[model samples]
Target: MTRQKWTTEEQEVWLEERKPAFLIANQKRCAAKSFYPDLVKEFRDKWPVPPVTQAEIDDAGSVELATRVKRDKYDKRTSSWYPNNTRTLSAHGGANEILKIKSQPQPRKLQAWQAYHALTYESKWKPHVNKAWTTYKEEWLAEHPKEKPEKTRLEVMVEFMKGKFNEENDDMKKRCEEYRNPEMQAVLNPAKAKPQAAINEAFQSAINLLPRTLATIGESLVKQTGWNITILAGGPMPDTDGTILTYLSHSGKTKEGDSFDKFLGKKDYDDHVLCPFEKFLHASFSMDGEDDKEKEMDDEEWKKQNSESEENENQTENVDQTKNGNKKSVGGLSEYEKSKAKNIAQLKLVMENLNENYPFPEDLVPKPALKKPAAKKEKKEIQQPVERRASMRNKGGDKDRYVM
Candidate 1:
């Protein structure tokens, strides 16, 4: 509409007559449907909820002061973790204020951790990791004459293993051939591999064997305290990404076990426990034959290891590129895409609000010529109704609950 300065009388009349108000029910209002109740219920159900008190919330924050205090405490302790050491007991001070999430390892016939770190560790491993490391290191170095690639993790690991086992290297050419074999598939793509043989002998010795290294797969979301709410997620690789589980596995033991689920203590907290996150050094990332530390680390002690690897390893075509990339690619946005998608969503919601009665102006609204918003995919069925399960409080007297 063309604008013209309104006279005082005209402005007064417009204010009195043109202002619009629709007598819509609260249920029909957009604000009513958008958030509040639904979001609140979901948040609360996510349970042992965020600290119930202000003091706990204040204690939970990771201010420079808290970080420094935590660092000093951890520094004084018997460990060499980095500057912001989250593992210190100081870090767990107001922890219950944070919502904790941990991967619950599923009982599996074979876990990669067992296969890779077995006491008979070198048996099935030598054919793959060493060869791939030697091969990739050579080709990568040769191709880039000027650029000295930071040694790949595998290369560093091979060096460590060679010295530890007092093992000698095979010919470089022979190593390359081993790397190329079909059976060495995990060398190229770690997600799939001949995980250590999980035979009965391995299971029998598991308390003594599986290297749930003290290292953590990811950093703790909240480091300055303990947690009240801990959500259990199903880990895809089952303890591969977790810390030393030997003793946790040890405590859960039966005269005959591994056949039973929840045998591992944290596997049910009734149980409890976690790290660098990505920056882990002391913890070995090798897929095979890591040197053993007799004091097998447990869930409670997980958050205490190296913060990161020695360095951010280079990505090469020959390794970890062939299989399973969808692992991290399913989320959207450059904010621009998100802004557009969000705008479209808002427009559709506006259209619903107008709903044939109170229509918005033609040019301002998405025009009839413009394409309609894409239909939303149906939400996946909740095969497991785990909602509200976390919210249930401990009511004291024993009661049987349906897992389903």
Candidate 2:
């Protein structure tokens, strides 16, 4: 029997009729190959490639072209291919088509980090990204309402910055209120309220006692100094009768003549007395104006002694130069003079600390005055009132008015 050649229209009709069966067969083959790749490989190895003639090659190429055309037509009609519009497998293709389907390009899902970075940095995409994220969160919550896992990196960053934003908002609100009120302006504006030097002096004074306290009492006690000693010692309790309190009471007298134990239990003596005494000792021994005055006097005495020593040295050198025909030499300050200078420097440091710790009021600060001239002026001013009264009495002929 001879094979019959079909016209173009007839071939199209035939292919359309056979398309469903071809697709069913292709799907079954793909499933089998996917499930049993080893079996497929073994079968291919058993039936290796056969030699092809020129006529066979030509026929195969023509058939492949036709299959491709049919696949394209079917894809265009159904729009069923992937987004790239690329076919992965075909009924007319080989086993490679099945593998292609397995390795088909999937839609690229956004990673958490990538999505977060884009949302944070890309202004254009932020709204859309945030909307999508909000939707995802709503859906996720709906699915797993009760479950709460650790926050993601983006979530943590947002939460941390959120607090900063709130603080900034509060500060802005305060500034706005300050702008509306004239009285609050001076206090609210840090630059205008306190001068930098005053602020620095206050800080220096506050920290001046720190070094001495640390040297005397260690860091632990200094850190815990804020706590009440009664709380540190233990909760409220009655003091023992035969303790150090009794001995101290014997050494000292109380206003009420109460026993030391009773006094200790009644008031917070540790806070009122001991702490203040310690601070006083630290300040007194550390450095003060009295120490500075003493150092200045010592320095003057040292200068006088140094000058005398230099003069004596010069005289001795002159004598030696006359006796041995050697050159005369000048001498430097004595060791005692050098020691005085060092002591003065130490005293000066103390004066600085005193000034910082105990700042004087502007009214109390003493101003330089010419004592003799001021005294004379005050005397003349006082006599003027008396002289005026005397002249008035003499003019009025009232001698008794200005009594002796």
Candidate 3:
């Protein structure tokens, strides 16, 4: 009988459905034949061929003989003898090759929702899907190197959700604006709007000016007098326009303790202890006469005038003595002169104390040597009184004096 060719539909049905069923049934038969010798013989008998003749056996080469001698050789086994047998169907050539070609897996086609569900819920398909996606991304990037790759499945889903939320929010805002009732409109508008407060421009100007003015004055004082000034902390005060203030302080030590906390001020700190300390520093350290040049010039002019007056007075006294016999004592110095003299004396004392305590730089100060026994004895005598005076001074006074 002549074999009939399969139509397209029949070929598809056989490949998609009937082929797998046939494979399973043939496998079962093969397994059964392994246990039953008669079943095996029956399958071999169905595809019978003539036995090898004596001449053909003699002509067989060594390799062919060795291959034929193997017990599980395809031709020798009943399992692979029949066409529909699982082993025959799985073989590498002929009908087996056709089956393998037909059985090549079809590319799965899924709807968007189905694909999402499969990716999310189907663990078995995840590896295959990930591998396919990676391959597709690489190919797409190769084709269009400049464009960014597509968003991931999860990212796309998240963006979809965000878009839905924004749409809902916009609808809500529109509904709020379109509400007809007056109370509802007022409620919505009031709830959405920010509140504003009334501002006093004049008060704000003054508030802002206060700290700036104070800072300017403090800076000028520091530059003129070389006093170290520090603005420790500052901030604006609520409900007081734009008023900002800072805590003023210095880094010196005082009799009580640190001068920083003791001399703290909100404004006009230059008028306090800083001014006096600066004056004392300038006076004590004014060796080049740079700080008090004007004062010195005034003093010289006053001294010249006073000396001329004294000379005239002396001439008058001499004339009186020559004319009368007795003269009155010269009047005392003026209050300004007395005060100036006192200040000069105080400045000299301060300088002397500073020299004794801190002294000048080591390079400028002379150091005594005590290499010999005689010099050592003299050095001890000199330092003994100085150390004793220092100890007595430390014990007598408030030792926490300002450092600068």
Can you list the residue pairs that collide in candidate 2? none
lDDT of 2 by residue, 206-303 (tens): 33322222222322222222211111111100121101110011111133533223355524444333333223323333333232211112434434
Order of quality (lDDT): 3, 2, 1
lDDT tens digits, residue span 1-404, model 1: 74553324543343233222111212345423443244334323532132234453367564555555544443233112111222345645662354554555744433333223332235555666677667767887899867876787666665555443344234533443444454554564455554565443354343222122111111122122211112222111223432222211111112343311233243332211111111111222212343322233332233222111111334333222113110111111111122334444554554454345434334224424423334232122221322433333222221111110
Candidate 2, poorest ten consecutive residues by summed lDDT: 241-250
Shift in Å, residue 266, candidate 1: 34
Q: How do all the candidates rank in terms of TM-score, highest first?
A: 1, 3, 2
- Minimum summed lDDT over a 10-residue window in model 3 is located at 325-334
Whose TM-score is greatest here? 1
Candidate 3 lDDT over 1-404, as tens digits, reads: 74543334543343344345445655686544443354445434654434555555566655457445432342344333234433444445652132111343653544333323322334343555566557766887999998876767565444443443354555543453343333444354444223433234444444433333334444444443333344333333233332222223332233344444343442323333233233444333333422232122233443343345435443432121112211111111121222434556665666565456545545334457444458667777867755554532212221111111
Q: Count the backbone clashes (under 3 Å) in each candidate.
A: 21, 0, 0
lDDT of each: 0.32, 0.36, 0.39
Between candidates 1 and 3, which one is better according to lDDT? 3
Q: How close is candidate 1 to the true structure, as a TM-score?
A: 0.15
